[model samples]
Target: MDFERSLDLLWRDKGETPQPTRGRKPKLTLDKVIATAVALADAEGQATGSMSQIAKELGVGTMTLYTYVPGKAELLDLMVDSVLAERDLPGPGDPLPDGWREQVRLYADRTLTVFRRHPWIQGMSMVRPVLGPGLMAGQEYLIATVSDIGLAPRKAAAAANGIEVYVQANAALTAETAQVEQQTGQSTDAWWGQRSVFWEKYFDVDRHPAMTRMWESGGYDVDTCEAVDEAFVFGLERMLDGIEALVS
Candidate 1:
């Protein structure tokens, strides 16, 4: 399917929600609590947000939050799911036509967009299995799309892993960039440019031919948005190529 057509379908899927009420009331719901926590995290860093903080924002006592979420861990999980629930998958029968590559790229892009907005997601590193319905739904979409390419279940699973890893890696890098800029008061490009001059003067170019060549060629000047798009496509394509070898 054309990209635009696929996106239209995805948007329709993302529209599955009722508008939140504006005024405060006597009762609290898990949805409202999660939304408050998410907004708090968006405005302030996630580390600074707590049940007490969110409760104050919502004009409730700290203990009241527990009525919605059992504890902070559950609150965090709810926050993550609240964000993930906003993601859209390609609609039924609207799967990418170029095999798994396009599907993976689209998935990675959508995921990166979410992580970029919520950079604190980088702090969530666990080997435990994903149980959140939102996350499970995303994985299911990826597996089903990959299965459409005539890939075996195992290979498709691996391919999905590769796509998710790529997205997470990029999100981590983006978050680090933001962190570095905040600390040094310099953009990534500015910081790198200032450091590169020192390196060129101190190090022998001949010692690292590949590094020297890339630096001299100004290859690091690649546009950030374009680089992200290219990386997702390149990595997904190479992964799919490997899977095709295995499946065929």
Candidate 2:
């Protein structure tokens, strides 16, 4: 989609409900189309989420959806911005809360929340980012928060990007793990147990002494292992520590 068209759609007022037209009343509004598409993506995933699927979910013809959204690519851009609009980030003028580390931690946590809420978003290509208003606002908030601290502009921007990458990568893994558990109807421990049996049968422990030792030490046991939240916190702190060292 062209930049102008994307900007128009993303910046369109989603608050005002669609009004009845002169001839035939509109069956689907832009907000409805976006919401329905989000629901479809959440349920069926991005790969299976198609124009026809969204149209079927909304009980409208495929061509009808085209009037509201040009195509799946444009629709996806809308969906991304729509999801980002849900973020509860502090405004640029808002003061940094407590220590810089704490503020950065909060930022990471909030970003993770968005990813957890929309797992399918992780699948979308962020390489060529769609700089919609919602996403731009989020970036502004992150950079502002970091810059509000002692970090210089360049460092602050880099730090914010680092935090984002960490949160997104981990959130994607966590979401995938949850999806697997849900589909298989098995907890992580149970799934690991099944895999362990296969490893015990055919795997040669002699070849990988360190891995074997770690497995024997209960490092691989899901029941006793650190929770995802704990791991995230630990990793986040370490990442912050590195950034702090740089600042010092």
Per-candidate RMSD, Å: 8.4, 3.4
- For 1-248, candidate 1 gives per-residue lDDT tens digits of 13332223223335654222243343776577778888887666443587788999999888776554556765676677657656776656765547566676677777777776776665665245234666776888777777766766787778777766767687667665564565467776686676776785877877888988997798756865567657766776787678778767
TM-score of each: 0.77, 0.82
Q: Runs in model 2 with CA error above 4 Å? A: 13-25, 94-96, 182-188, 221-227
lDDT digits (tens) for residues 1-248 of candidate 2: 65666666787765653342233456868889889888877775443587888888999878788777667888889998888777767776676667777777776777677766776777776667777876877778767667765788888889888887787678777666655665567877787777876796888889989999998997766562256777888899998888878777
Task: State the weakest 10-residue window (summed lDDT) of model 1.
Answer: 1-10
Which clashing pairs does model 1 show?
none
Go through the candidates in order and give each one's C-alpha lDDT. 0.66, 0.74
Top candidate on lDDT is 2
**Candidate 2, residue 73: lDDT:** 81
State the local distance difference test value for candidate 1: 0.66
Top TM-score hit:
2
